[model samples]
Target: MELEVRNLSVSRGGVPVLEGLSFRLAPGRALILRGPNGIGKTTLLRTVAGLQPPLSGEVGLDREAMAYAAHADGIKATLTVAENLSFWAQVFGTGDITPAIDGFALDELRNRPAGGLSAGQKRRLGLARLLVTGRPVWVLDEPTVSLDVDAVAMFGAAVRRHLATGGMALIATHIDLGLDEAEVMDVGPFKAKPPKVEDFDEVFL
Candidate 1:
């Protein structure tokens, strides 16, 4: 599977987040998106996932090839970890999450409601959903957020395994994910934001 971003631009409330950012990924490879806070990392990831629109560019993916894990855990707070996995698996038509859950050592938390799980556990559950997706191209946003060092290491191992099996991932993270020979795309050079106090926040006040 292949994914290419062509001159992608993103703007919110007339504020430009990304400009002319572009890249390509081939099968069995991974790319890491790097930038400081509020530098459009989440915005770009959302654009790739089709969750949001690109302000002035396009995102193209090969036919039948895509998946995403958002910065915020996509797991439903009301559902148990297992239930969430089951729902996504049936919807996406792929492997069950029990194996993934076991890999992440999440089996014990499977019966717990997502809302009751800790932050790290929720992220793990989010990762588990990807195993259910079974898509060739994956876009992950801050995938290790809220995870401890060891859990982060575990997630990296999972990503390596996926790539070894010919799957590709686009990961946005402040910490290294330990992927094999991953290319680093520096988005920091694109930061274009003013401090909140620099905004006109008194329009109606």
Candidate 2:
């Protein structure tokens, strides 16, 4: 499978942040997004995930084939670790969560309440949810946040396995996650230029 974007423009709060962005990612590969803060990396990923509309152009891919992981962990504090995974497994119509649990080394904490897990553990749990989705395309936002070195390694291993199985990922991260063959896309050049002086003044006047 391949994801193609044609001259896509994305915005937040009706203000454009990225423009003229286009790229195609084939299966068994990963594309890393790089840029300074507020340069629209998250906005681009969100738009691609269909969480928000792109200001222009198109995203060519099957929505059903993509799984999106936002910046937040999306965990239920009251539930146990295994329970949280179970809930998502059911939502994604997957029955076996063994791989997700093993992939993240979450077996020991399986019975613990999510509320009690440390920040890194919670992050791992959130990432593990992705495995159970069974979708081929993963769109992730800063997936390594709060993860320790070992956890990051585990995450990298998981991503490698996904690619090995012919899946692809589009990741936005500040630090390296050791994706050897992943292509890097610097979003800097695609940042939307500021409005003209008169146009900017007109909005406030």
Candidate 3:
């Protein structure tokens, strides 16, 4: 199934940020969102992921088909790396954590508590959760924040593998992931204009 966003308008803190944005991501494809920081990339991603409602337009997709990963690791501090993957696996009913453990190179850290891991290791463990999601579309925001060069390459490889299996990715990142085939959308053109005084006056009228 494809993911479609048509004439989507989104806001942050009740103020509009993007308007009239549209795109379609087919199976096995990737779309990278680009713009200046604070340009509402996160808001757009969240809206698409159904984490927040859009001010207008439509995000057409089954909520179950998309898996979202933000800057936060989303791991349980008290659980071991392996346990964390297993938990998400169970949540998604995928029931297998081996690939995720190996994909992110978390094998050695599997038995260690998540809270004890270094920043990069924690990030890896967090990302590994995506593999177990079994969802077709990945909605990621700054996925490489705490990763090193090698780890970034690992992530790039994982994404390629996912696409190879007909999975799609919607990512917002500044650095290149070596995904030459992926399309980039610069959201600068969609920046929302401030509402005029009369527009606000209509609210109370």
Candidate 4:
């Protein structure tokens, strides 16, 4: 499977953020999207995931081949950890959430409400959604933001396993994912040099 973008351009608040940006990724490879804060890394991923519309671009994905988990928790506070995974799995037409619950080492928290979990626990629950969804292209925004050292390692290992299984991922993060074959894409220079206040009405939909 391959994901292709051509002459991609995005503008928020009437100011262009990304212009003429393009890239392609295939199965079994992980692409690390590295950049300083606010260089449109998340915006790029969001566009690919159809979470936002690009000003002008083409995000040609085998639609069924992708799933996205952004910086947001993506977990329902009132639901139990297991309930969250079950909800995602069912939504994606996957068989069950049990396997993902096991994969993310979330067995112990399965019975606990998501709101009661720690930051790391919540992130894991969000990551677990990817496994249960069974999609090939993972568009992740800061998948390891709040994890401790061990949790970070666990997240890295899980991502590695996904790559081994022919799944591709595009991750936007400030930390190294510890994947040997990871291709690093420097998005630093591509960012708008200085952060500017943009109007919400024109920035996002």
Candidate 5:
């Protein structure tokens, strides 16, 4: 099923950041979110991922249909590369970590402990988790943070593959991922206005 976001309003730290935002992501398509720093891109992604509630509107997809990858690697430091993928594979009930290992070039480091890997390696492992998820929609926030040029290309390819398989992606990143078919959305127009002084006074009245 396609992912639909209807007139969504999201907040950060209990203060509104964006409002009246709507978008739809069809199967085999990708949408990229753009805005200056602190523009609530992360907040909006979190809301759509069901990590946090939106102030208003609705995210049409359920948590099980989407996989979220944020800045943190989200790997178990004690687990080996293969083990980490296996764990997520089990959690998502999608057997076989082979594709994930091969997708991010993790075969060479499969036996290595996550704690000992370099930052870029760790990021690759984290991104690999998305493959094992078997979810239709990927909600990623700065997914290429620690990736090098080659690693970035690997990620771009993986995203393309996902889309080709009828999966969708909602990504927030400044880097050019080289996905020419992806649509871009700027959050500037949806920035929430500050509450009027009288609105605050009404709270205590």
Candidate 6:
């Protein structure tokens, strides 16, 4: 499986943010997006995931082959840890979640409600959903947000396992998640330039 971005452009709230960005990710590889805040890392991910339309150009990939995990944990607070994982597994047409359970060290908390988990625990559960997706491509936004050092290590190992199985990942994060093999792309250079002083003033006309 592969992902191709050709001259892609993205905008937020009618303001162009990133432009002319292109990249390709082959199987068993990862691409880490690095940039300052509000540079459209998340926008680019959402665009590629097909959650939102790009301002221009194209992203070539089967939507079904990619699993998107936004910055939010996206867990139902009322559901138990096991229940949350099970729900996603069923949705993905898989009856087995043992690997995801063990991968994120959620065995002991399986019966615990998601509401009772700490911020870090909730983040872990959110990431575990990727395992249930069974998709070859993973798109994660700031996946390491609330995770501690040890949990970050676990996340890294899980990502490594996914890559070993011919899966690829596109991640946007500030801190290092310890994915040494993943190629890096700085979004700064891709940011769209601001309008000229006269052009900006003319917009009020």
Worst 10 residues of 3 by lDDT: 196-205
lDDT of 2 at 99: 96
TM-score of each: 0.85, 0.96, 0.96, 0.89, 0.96, 0.95
Local accuracy of candidate 6 as per-residue lDDT tens digits, 32-150 = 99999988999889988988889999988978888999978779999999999999999999878999999999999999999999999999999999999899999999999989999
Q: What's model 1's lDDT at 120?
A: 87
1-205: candidate 3 lDDT, tens digit per residue: 8999999999999999999999999999999999999999999999999999999999999778889999897988999998989989999999999999889999888899999999999989888999999999999999998899999999999999999999999999999988999999999999999877767668787
The 0-to-1 C-alpha lDDT of every candidate, in the order given, reads 0.81, 0.94, 0.93, 0.83, 0.95, 0.92
Off by over 4 Å in 5: 199-205
Which clashing pairs does model 4 show? 13-202, 13-203
Which ten contiguous residues of candidate 6 have the minimum total lDDT?
193-202
Candidate 4 per-residue C-alpha lDDT over 1-205 given as tens digits, one digit per residue, 9 for 90 to 100: 6788787877666567777777888878888988877778878888888877778878888456779998886788999998888888889899688778877899999999999999888988898889988898999999998888888888888888898998898999888778869888887655543345487676466
RMSD of each: 4.3, 1.5, 1.6, 4.5, 1.3, 1.7
What would you estimate as the lDDT of candidate 3?
A: 0.93
TM-score of predicted structure 4: 0.89
Kindly list the per-residue Cα lDDT of model 2 for residues 1-205, writing each as its tens digit.
Answer: 6999899999999889999999999989999999999999999999999888889999998678889998798999999999999999999999789999999999999999999999999999999999999999999999999999999999999999999999999999999999979999999999898756767668887
| Pairs of residues at least 3 apart in sequence or in different chains that clash in candidate 1 | none
Q: After superposing candidate 2 on the true structure, give the runs of residues whose Cα lies further than 4 Å from its correct spot.
A: 197-205
Pairs of colliding residues, candidate 6: none
Cα-based lDDT at residue 183, candidate 3: 100
The candidate with the higher lDDT, 1 or 5, is 5
lDDT of 5: 0.95
Error at 83, model 3, angstroms: 1.1
Clashing pairs in 2: none
Q: Of the candidates shown, which would achieve the greatest TM-score relative to the real structure?
A: 5
Question: What's the number of clashes in each of the models?
Answer: 0, 0, 0, 2, 0, 0
